[model samples]
Target: MPYQVLARKWRPQTLQDMVGQEPIRRILSNALEQHRIHHAYLFTGTRGVGKTTLARILAKCLNCETGITATPCGTCSTCQAIDAGKFLDLFEIDAASRTKVEDTRELLENVPYPPVQGRYKIYLIDEVHMLSNHSFNALLKTLEEPPQHVKFLLATTEPKRLPITILSRCLQFHLKPIPLELISDHLHYICKQEQVTADKTALNYLSKAANGSLRDAMSLLDQAIAYGQGSIKSDDIHAMLGTIAQQNLFPLMKALAAQDSNQVFHAIHLLAEHTPDFSNVLEELISLFHQIAVSQVITYQQKTDQQITELAALFKPEDVQLYYQIALLGRRDLAYTPSPQQGFEMTMLRMLALQPKQMVVQVETPTLTVAESPSWQEILPKLDLSGMAYALAANCTLEKIEDHKVILQLSANHQPMLNTKLKDRLRESLSNYFKQAMQLDIIITAAELYTPAKKQEQEQVERLTDATKAATQHPKIKQLIEMYDATIEVSLL
Candidate 1:
């Protein structure tokens, strides 16, 4: 009669009711039907992915009054008692608390005794990894060879902590995290059954916020129901979860795709009122870019808004990849910045600034005279390059320039930067610099000539060497060694 949370209330009583774990359910079901019961079984997965729930369902199957069966007759007293958590033979231990070797020994002392009320004495230990090394040692012998009437169901989120000796004895069933769509559908079904009016999009946010855990999704759903006063909508869910509105992100994406600084700032200002977590905002932006990238390759029914489709069309595939990589790096470096907002703004600025430079579209070639020919190092800094194009140029040494073809040697290690798109951009930049359409041929040979990057490194090393020599010959250094016989640990300034 007491109030039960949706997670507990909707707990799968049989394997058939479980969602998004078909493989695990099928294996357990086959084991039950074939009576291929193992003395010890281990269920390993993250929290709320039905590790304990599956263990309970397996216990019911073992003790069901009709017989040991895959599909337990839920009407029977044994199943009913187990469901109510009052079954005598089913001992559910929270190993986190009872982790001492003595507790393990005491618990195993009863393993020899026959089941009091059921066919099998089920020892369901939750968080089995929390047991001490000595306790695991204590459990090893009995766990390997328990009594005929005994069964061990070990569940742990951190299975790696469990000793290999104990792990080897058990039939390990590693449950996977439920898929996003499945969790969303499950939440929608629960909302309908509970008479809770909810938008599909609202359920989607909850499902994603759950991060592939059904119990987590259900908990968030309960909070959302109360937050929305029983009617769940996307806007309210976003507000409740402190999540960036997906719609607000579209304008920023549009601005980024168009390389419009003003619109990017305006869009970010609109979100400023919400005081959004900029890291999460970047994450949402990254997600949108990822979706757009996926759309380029695989053709699927568009569940996205017209804005997303239009934005996807606006940006090329290479741009999406570049923006995604920049956003990820920005998010990674965000914590070290002065503030989250500044870090986020700089990231957006970077995307816009790099866009035009990285664009591979044809443009007017710059005028150049043969009399003004300069070294590759000087030529590199003079060229309008940034991002991968700039990086590719900096790492290359000019081999030869004849008529319309320019040959360069890049280090073999940096060959990953030698893609068709980068090559095309480099060729275009060279054509503009040379005032003629040029073909850039790159060879993956060691750069013997002074590259821009190599020249810069050489300059830095020379400056450091000069500074160290200057300091070593200083008057103060001579006085210190002569006066006190002090040996100084000198380093470059």
Candidate 2:
């Protein structure tokens, strides 16, 4: 016997053996146990997510010699025949090749007849959405009122293309993409069973590359086993996939965070030697920035490397956001560039050049005159703060300034936004702005106090009022109003 690929060899024979679709599995199992089987069932999802496989399992459950069951006995001839794709009653049709109305009519002609060897004649149509409009119309009547002896199992990647009439008659189950961790774990289990040596990191790389498809992961695993000569390794997987190691991306991120032009180019030069897919490199960078941003804003629970945590602390949240957006655009525009490497290099350079420069505050403290004492609103813009730190500062009113301390009064409503990190950032910004080290002391107060945000809101309202008044007074506007009998929309103005 020829050796079968991992995907086929590991094909789930029972519903319980299927992985990563617990909700669908539970629903199908209950329906089977209750014997509340639908005449026509539609399974819709992306490729390799087990739409067709689930359909086959359902067929076996209905036709098994032991009788209809949620757990069909694999040894029974009916179950064995269905699993081997030799069952006479299970008509597995690839609708992509036979999409004409004639083909649909020909298939439905047998629907009225009783099963030759099984309990029910099952019609499993894969990629059913590929059927033409006329074909769907031709199948609509039969699909809506199929014989008691017939069952229709339809699977498609795109269900929206299916007519409402056809969709309405069938019980649709949307299979979700398998999660990465599930795929990784399944691959690890398979490797152990196959007696193949494999690294966890290699499986993880394959999992990510599979993009939620277990079949794709298994196929990639088969290729990886051959590529590594039976021992799966991370470096071999990366090379096979045209991607760089995760650690290789760290140096580039570090260089970007430091905003060192020479280091950035040097990192890129070293990365290019690996002949990686530049688009994938950009995607990795974007993912890293996103993780960093999440780490900065929240108590990120996802397991991250120590370097990522350090980089998260080293880079500001706003900078991470900016870099993420730039990397996104860079990836999109990569194809139009002269070369992938050039496009990637330009994207990295753009990130480095556009990063906000650190303000060089003089260390010496200067005495300020009474006239030179600036208001909080005046100082807010110059602080160059962003994210929650900016919001915290904007919502607080300056209470007083002591020798080494700055007191702020935060409205009780906005007190929830206050945190130790924001307070430290605010303090550092103030110290920089005043050219002296200062500590922040925030007091939550219910007393009404003017803040920069409120001041700015008032100023905007005044400007809008002035603009509306000016627009209403314009001669052209008066003529148009008189002719059209229209009132001025102050908000629009």
Candidate 3:
């Protein structure tokens, strides 16, 4: 037998063998078991997501010699014929090539006839959206009211181009892109069955490159196997796909975290030597920033790499967010640059230039006795807080400190900020500031209290009133006001 590619060799024969697409698989299985088959079915999704492949499986299920079943026996002649693409009843049409109204009419002419071989005459149209408007108009009537012996299976990557009349008449199933982990696992399983030596990291890289398409992943695996001479390695896969190793990105991230310009350029110089796809490098950096931000915000049960943990601890949450946005913009603008490496270098430089400089200050820790407890307003600025935690702290007034518990009264208006995460963060910040373990009790009160936020508001109002009064009394202002018949507006001031 001639050499068959991995994608063709591993083509799923039964519905159960199909990877991913659990929902659609389940639905089709139930429909088959119940014998509630529809006349026309439409499968829509991106390329290589098993749209046409699913249609073929459905055809087999309907035409199998063992009778209609979700689990078709691949050995039966009918199943074998369908699999071999020699089934008389299965009319596989590529709408891209035969898209004229005449071609459509000619095809629909056979719909009224009964099956010559299989139980039902199945029409599997691939790239059905490529059919012209006139062709779709010709297919509409026959599609809506096909014979009991006929089943229409239409698959398309672009379903929007399909007319609503055609879409409404058919039972549509949108197949989602296969997830990365699922694709990777499927590749691993295939490697085991094929007796091929492969690295797990290499499979992961291929899976990401596939972007949720199992067929594409399999094709890439075939190329990878050939490239590695029957074995797969991560470095070989990286070279094949023009992607860099995950470790290559860590050095740049570490440099950025440390704000070391020389080290940043050095890291970039080393990375450029690999001649990586800089756009992909930017994407990797963006992904790393996102991971770091997630790590900073939440505790993870999974064991993270020591480098990621260290980077997360070194960089602030806000800094991660800023870097993520900058990397995203950099990736988007990479194509317009003179060269990809220059674009990548500029993006790194931009991150350093725009990042807020951290100021180091040394202050002696003051011991506070219960009798000498500081005002809540004074403590608010000292606590390490940002985002919702800072907002929650600013709107709270210290009630009392009993033992290690710090009681706070929160304004009822800002009650929405009192989630467990924010509350725990506030408690942690307070504990850190006081140089001792502390517990927090926040009571929401509708009654107004002098919170730090309210105090600041009052001081701002007083200053504005003083400024307006001073402006109204000024000689130049009074003369201009009288000349223009204008009254002083504090808001304008």
Please give the RMSD to the true structure for each candidate, in Å: 16.0, 16.3, 17.2
lDDT of 3 at 288: 85
Better of 1 and 2 by lDDT: 2
TM-score of each: 0.71, 0.73, 0.73
The residue-by-residue lDDT of candidate 2 on 1-493, one tens digit each, is: 9989999999998899999889999999999999999999999999899998999999999999888899999999899899888999999999999999999999888888899999999999999999988889888988877889999999999999999999999999999999999999999999999999999999999999999999999999999999999999999998899888877988888888888889999999999988899998888888888878877877847776677788898898878877888798899889999999999999988888767443222222222222222478788899989999998898998889899989999989998999898898999989999899998899999987688788767766766676667767777667646643547655521
Off by over 4 Å in 1: 299-305, 356-493
Q: In candidate 2, which residue pairs clash?
A: none
Kindly give the stretch of ten consecutive residues in candidate 3 with the minimal lDDT sum: 359-368
- For model 1 the local lDDT of residue 293 reads 88
Q: What TM-score, to 2 decimals, does candidate 2 have? A: 0.73
Model 3 clashing residue pairs (backbone)? none
Q: Which segments of model 2 are wrong by more than 4 Å? A: 300-304, 357-493
What is each predicted model's overall lDDT from 0 to 1?
0.86, 0.88, 0.87
- After superposing candidate 3, which stretches have Cα over 4 Å from the reference? 357-493
